[model samples]
Target: MRNHTALTTFILLGLTQDPQLQIFLFIFLFTTYILSITGNLTIITLTIVDLHLKTPMYFFLQNFSFLEISFTTACVPRFLYSISTGDRTISYNACAIQLFFTDLFGVTEFFLLAIMSYDRYVAICKPLHYMTIMNNKVCQNMILCCWTASLVVIVPPLCLGLNLEFCDTNIIDHFLCDANPILKISCSDTWLIEQMVIGSAVLTFITTLLCVALSYIYIIRTITRFPSAQQKKKAFSTCSSHVIVVSITYGSCIFIYVKPSAKEDMTINKSVSVLISSISPMLNPFIYTLRNKQVKQAFNDTVKKLVFLLKK
Candidate 1:
């Protein structure tokens, strides 16, 4: 088959074809996206306003919340609109933009978490030098590197997709402009791009995951060496929460992405995608705040001031 001209618009097959479930999906996703935005915003506000959270860890966290808000915004709103309006057609350019930003945010989130893990490790394993190691300028540079690296890592696959031959088949079998779904519609042999995507996914996910894992290994070992049971508990408590959040995020992603097939089962892939794109971002705020005593105290303090101002 000869290569074909580029198509103008692509129809997203969306999450489902079930007319009966469209309204329900719309409401559920709409509520979830709203909550994701609200929760992440609260975290950001508290982190910025409260002096208690003026450390490097929370500095990183503020950026993390901003990233999560971006991650959720990139896909959920468009997906929700598609579900509600029954208009699944997306311009090729729009799809390309979505693919790039979502992947950029997704990749950066992974690296940020890794850097945060190192932050925790330094904070715990070398409390005397946390500030010296993770100073303001250094922290700023680390964050800059994460965003820059995300852009660097996503360019190749995006360029590949942009130059693809669609052969007039413009229906994407997923909600957003996912790589696998886009590849399936292209007339060109996608073997090289597929390999590149897989390589990139594996490289990004696994390397960050290993960094996180290695940091925690040292953290766990150090905490276990503490002389007092109370000290041991406090140390583990800090890192454990991060580990849990990371585990849930990376675990779900590995299940979905690191596979032989782009999507072995659309239903399973979609379910896992929802976990990554919607549930995880929504849950991160709670995961981070509910477990951290400093954040809780900051929240209480912020509330007290607001209430006092209102009464006056």
Candidate 2:
């Protein structure tokens, strides 16, 4: 972390300049942030306490909920503060830290989702060996690999960003400190850093997406071969929640990061990003709980236990 940049503080322009809009955004974001935290935390708590959820699938779901919480926490609260207090300036180091964490959590999530897909594949395609193959130890190691892989992808570009000289301008277009907006303000040569960022994004996206795609392919093929229609329905139901999440995660990201026309609509991109960080996290818990019988049952059971204790 070298202090080579001339400008130490960058002003974020935020989503809009209207006072009315800012108030609306603040209220909206705060509500969603609270909901996101509560939802993900509920999932985490349920996974921890419910014996019925003591499966490899719920293990990954627990971690995914954690990642969603972490990812949203990285940016949402700060933006909310800025909106309410009318202070949009973030120090250079603070901006860098935010960028690093957001990327770390975001990248790790892609891998985690892929891992979840593989878990589903194993459960459906190779049920007899699922327990042995995806034991607790293996799940823990796979999560560690997700973090390690994310670091490998993000660290190089960030190190290069340290050498960026922000003498030109300090006003960022987006609500939060993100890679592209920061790079746009730098006076130094950003070609290499930009390339590396693109490479990292592509690598994470392609590799994880391929894993998810292949896993589902095999899963679908195996499910189709099952003799009983009831078996097929149950198998698909087990995977539907994960598939919906994967689609939303990948689709929004591809629109923002991989689309050729992304640069043309920065405002739209930022708005879509808000949905990704805030709305998506808030929605995931409901998606899982509503679609999953085991989770709903566990929640009901837990509620009953709490009610019984309260009565005593």
Candidate 3:
């Protein structure tokens, strides 16, 4: 740990300065954070307890739900505290820790989404061998690989960021300890780190994106050749939720991170960041459940059982 920093604590300039706006932001964040946590938890519980959802698709969803909870919890709750207490100061170590977890969870999600797309491809394109190919051990190994690959992608850049020296400015432009904003405020020459960040981001984006694209291409081709319209509809329906989620996750992220001029507009970027950390997580469970008959049926069964237990 390179502890060579004159500033021990950094002040976060939160979303707004107006007290009225702060109240609104606080309420909004609190509501979304609660919903996000509850929703993701429900997904995890359903996947664990519901026997019908023991398949590879739901298994991947369970892990993705956990990542959603972790990714949002990493930053949203702290910002909520900052708003409620009117204190925006985060210790150096705390900020670093937050950055690490956020990056780890966020990066892992990309790989996981790619893996889910592949799962769909196997189910649709190669149904006969799907069971054997994506068995319990195989699913677990794929998830483990996602985490391991994400660590490999992020560790180098994060290590370089840890050595950054902040000499003068202690006020971060954005709400969280994001890598780009932190690097902007550092006194160190960030040319190398900046390149590394871009390289890593590109690597994660391209690799996972290619996997998703290829998977879907094969899936769509397979679906088109199905003998009946009913079969085609069923195949496409299975993939709809994953496709929507991938679009939301990738679209927002590409706008925020991939563009060269993204940093020029901090306000828009911050709002999009909030959506990524809060809104997306809150919506994902609903998206999966609403479109999914198996999950919905499982939820209804669980509800009936709980009601019966309470009545007894």
Highest lDDT against the true fold, candidate:
3
| Clash pairs (backbone) in predicted model 3 | none
Alpha carbon lDDT at 116, candidate 1: 96
| Tens-digit lDDT string for candidate 2 (1-312) | 244555678899999999999998989999999999999999999999999899999999999999999999998999998998889999878988999999999999999999999999999999999999999999999999999999999999998888777665789899998887777767777778877877788888999999999999999999999999999999999999999999999999877776432234578889988999999999999999999999999999999999999999
Candidate 3, poorest ten consecutive residues by summed lDDT? 256-265
Q: What is each predicted model's overall lDDT from 0 to 1?
A: 0.86, 0.90, 0.90
Candidate 2 ranges with C-alpha deviation above 4 Å: 1-5, 259-265
TM-score for each of the candidates: 0.96, 0.97, 0.97
- Better-scoring candidate (TM-score), 1 or 3: 3
Q: Tell me how candidate 2 scores on lDDT.
A: 0.90
Q: Which ten residues in a row have the lowest lDDT in candidate 1?
A: 1-10
lDDT of 3: 0.90
* Residue-wise C-alpha lDDT for candidate 1, range 74-139, written one tens digit per residue: 989999888877889998778888988899999999999999999999998999999999999999
Ranking by TM-score: 3, 2, 1
Better of 1 and 2 by lDDT: 2
Model 1: residues with Cα > 4 Å off, grouped in runs = 1-4
